[model samples]
Target: MDKAFLIQFTGSMAAVAVLVGLAAWARIGRPSPGLDEARARDLLAEDFPDRQIDQLWIAREGRGALARSGACALVLIQVGDGYAARRLSWCQASSAMFRNGQLDIRLGEVAAPRAVLAFDNWPPKDLAA
Candidate 1:
């Protein structure tokens, strides 16, 4: 490639990097909101209109939640700057472990295979719903 072309390309790349860095510093993307019961309910309502949440548990830091709807369980987890929700039977879980006040669950999902939820208590009363 020509020297002038290389110089221009390098300058353009540097400019893009600077913009990305600034965006990151400013937190341009929507970070996960602290999920309260109402917020979680709203999100669940929007996602699963047919089901009604009978019981709900939010992670200590609002990182995730576990909700019981009818006979199934719903999981809401933070992914990147957003959240992902999944409804499944607890029996479908590949594994579950309690570590340092957090419960790690493997849901066997390709997009969101695992969720780490923190609660004040370990060995949650209801691991299955």
Candidate 2:
């Protein structure tokens, strides 16, 4: 290999590495901050302005939340750097299993399919309805 060619290739690789490091430091595409009940409600409000959440439960470590509005249920999940909301009836969920104070709900959708919410007690009664 020619010495000049090798030097140029090495320099290009270093430049790419530096750019990646700078992007990481800047938190480009970094995930959104953890959510509280109030923040989760705000996100739901944006996507579901007409609906009001009657009850809500925030997931462990702020991963997501479960909320009930009238007869419909809504889930707030983290997608990339933001949150996404899905409204569902109880029948829409493929499954919901509770174990160790967590309720795992499967919505059976292609985009936002599943959510695991944590509660201090067992799953809420209205969750199944």
Model 2, 1-129: lDDT tens digits are: 999999999999999999999988887675668899789989899999999888887777797887878877888877777778888884443247777877777877777567767766555554444
| Model 1 lDDT tens row, 12-105 | 9999999999988887675657999999898888889999887889999997788877667789998777778988875442246877888888
Clashes of each: 0, 0
TM-score of each: 0.71, 0.71
lDDT of each: 0.81, 0.78
lDDT of 2: 0.78
Segments in model 1 whose C-alpha atoms lie over 4 Å from true places:
1-31, 91-95, 122-129
Worst 10 residues of 2 by lDDT: 120-129
Clashing pairs in 2: none
